[model samples]
Target: MKLTNINKTFGNKKVLKNINLDFPTGKTTVLVGPSGSGKSTLLRTLNLLVTPECGQYEFEKQKLDFAKKISNKEKIFLRQKTGMVFQDYNLFPTKTVLGNIIEGPTQVLKEDKTHAITTAQQLLQKVGLADYATAYPHELSGGQAQRVAIARALAMKPKYILLDEPTSALDPELELSVLKVLLQLAREKQSMAIVTHNMVFAKKIADKIIFVENGEILYDGSPTEFFDPNNPNQRIRNFISSMTLEDL
Candidate 1:
């Protein structure tokens, strides 16, 4: 996908500014920046969750004219094409793990219930939560719940997934479970855009790195170049220095 001259404002605050970005197919791009730096907002814009006030958004040769009304067909196409995994596990409280995973495919995609449930079971196993299929959201631990959420996103068989601080709410030890699932996704060559503060994890998995600050992209490069101490970008060096030893 290619975004050009993207701009977004929330009342008096300019959240995204003349931003231009790209998410290439079959690669993981990590978005790194301080809190309130518009990283998450930018991810939302890519998925069309938060529309930019003005921009030329193109994906698969389809463009969104934000200056004009976005039709329901266009909105649905974007949402279905890119699955989103939020920081919090957004599963339905009343649904079991199996129920949550198959909802989108069965309802939105009009998939056969038996086929969707079969696919859901396979996804659950892939996330290492096959036993949790009958469990409700409240019955699982934080890590388990997030894994289920990932499975839910996968059930749609989307072109790619966008993650917003996926492990931010998990405990240090519990983070490994979701991170392992993500690592497997990376190995599987699943295209993704991730917003994260975990520099160490980013180094391990990111194919491309994009650093945004003050609503603009300051740097975009390969993970190797982004982490190089000799990198001439002082802001990136300063940002790395600011992270906790644990974060690195």
Candidate 2:
């Protein structure tokens, strides 16, 4: 996706400001920053979950105007091209894991129920939750629910997966489990834009790393350059210090 001249504001606060960026295909591009630094808002804009007040979103040669009126057809088309995994693990308490996974495919994509079940089972196994197919959201731990959330997103077969702090609520071990799955996906060249504060994981998985602060792109480069200990960017250095302490 190519973003140009993007801007978004809520009430008096500007969340994103004149952002110009590009996400290359088959790469893991990690977004990192302090809390409420507009990283999450930028990811949401890709899927149109949060529309920018003005911008040009170029995807697969199709350009959409965020500043103008968009048709329902256009929104649906964009949504079809991407999926998102939220930090809160948005799942249906009333639906079992299999039910949650199949909802999008059977209802939105109109896939056969039998086929959806087969796909869900495979995704469950991929996320190390094959036995939790019948478990409800409340019955699972934080990490398990997030895995189900990732499976649900994959079930859509989205061209890109936008992850928003998927393991923020997990303990160290649980966070590691989730991060391993993400790293594996990165190795397999899955297209994803992740919003995370996990510097260690970001350094390991990122093909490109972007740093956002105060509603603007502060830095965009490879992980090697972004995390260089001798880099003179004070803001980046401070943020990295905070993250390291938090991790400890």
Candidate 3:
């Protein structure tokens, strides 16, 4: 995915300014930045959840012009290529875990219920939540809820999954379990863009790391280059200093 001259402003506050970057396909890329750095805004723009004021986005060779209105049909097609997970597990209050997993496909895409159920079961097992299919989100812990969220995203079989501080809401132990599931997905060549504070997880699974500050990209390079002591970006340096090893 490539973004060019992307800009977004909320009222008078600018969140993204002239942002230009490319996200490689089939690679795990992490976007790391402090609060209010616009990482989440940038990710949301990619998924078309937040419309940019001005910019062009290129996904798999298709150009998305934010200046123009997109048809619902076009939005649906783009959504098929992308899935999003949030820090807050946004499961439906009335849906069981299994229902949450299958709802999107069965409703949005009009996929067969039997096929959706089969895929949902496999994804639940993948996320280590096979037995929680009948359980409600309220009955699960934060970590388990996030795992179910991941499962729900996977049930769409998207080409790229966008994760926004996925494990930030969980405890350390729960975070590790979810991270393991993510790493396993990466090993299986699932492409994803993760916005995270966990620097260590980025180092371990990310093929590339993009550092952002003040609505602009500070650095975009390999994980090794990002950690290199001689890197010139002050934002990168400050971020490293603020992070503890445990945050990884």
Better structure of 1 and 3 per lDDT: 1
lDDT of each: 0.92, 0.92, 0.90
Ten-residue stretch with the least lDDT total in model 2: 239-248
lDDT agreement of model 2 with the native: 0.92
Model 3 alpha-carbon drift over 4 Å, by segment: 245-248
Residues 129-201, candidate 2, lDDT per residue (tens digit)? 9899999999998889998999999999988899999988899998988898898888888899999988999
Cα-lDDT of candidate 3: 0.90
Candidate 3 C-alpha lDDT tens digits along 9-121: 99998999999998888899999988999999999988899999788988875888888887787788878889999999899989999999999999988999999999999
Candidate 1, 80-141: lDDT as tens digits = 98999998989999999999999999999999999999999999989999898999999999
> In terms of TM-score, which candidate is strongest?
1
Cα deviation of 191, candidate 2, in Å: 0.4
Q: Using alpha carbons, what is the TM-score of model 1? A: 0.97
TM-score, candidate 2, is 0.96
Cα-lDDT of candidate 1: 0.92
Clashes of 1: 0
Question: TM-score of each candidate?
Answer: 0.97, 0.96, 0.95
Q: Give the RMSD in angstroms, all C-alphas superposed, for model 1.
A: 1.4
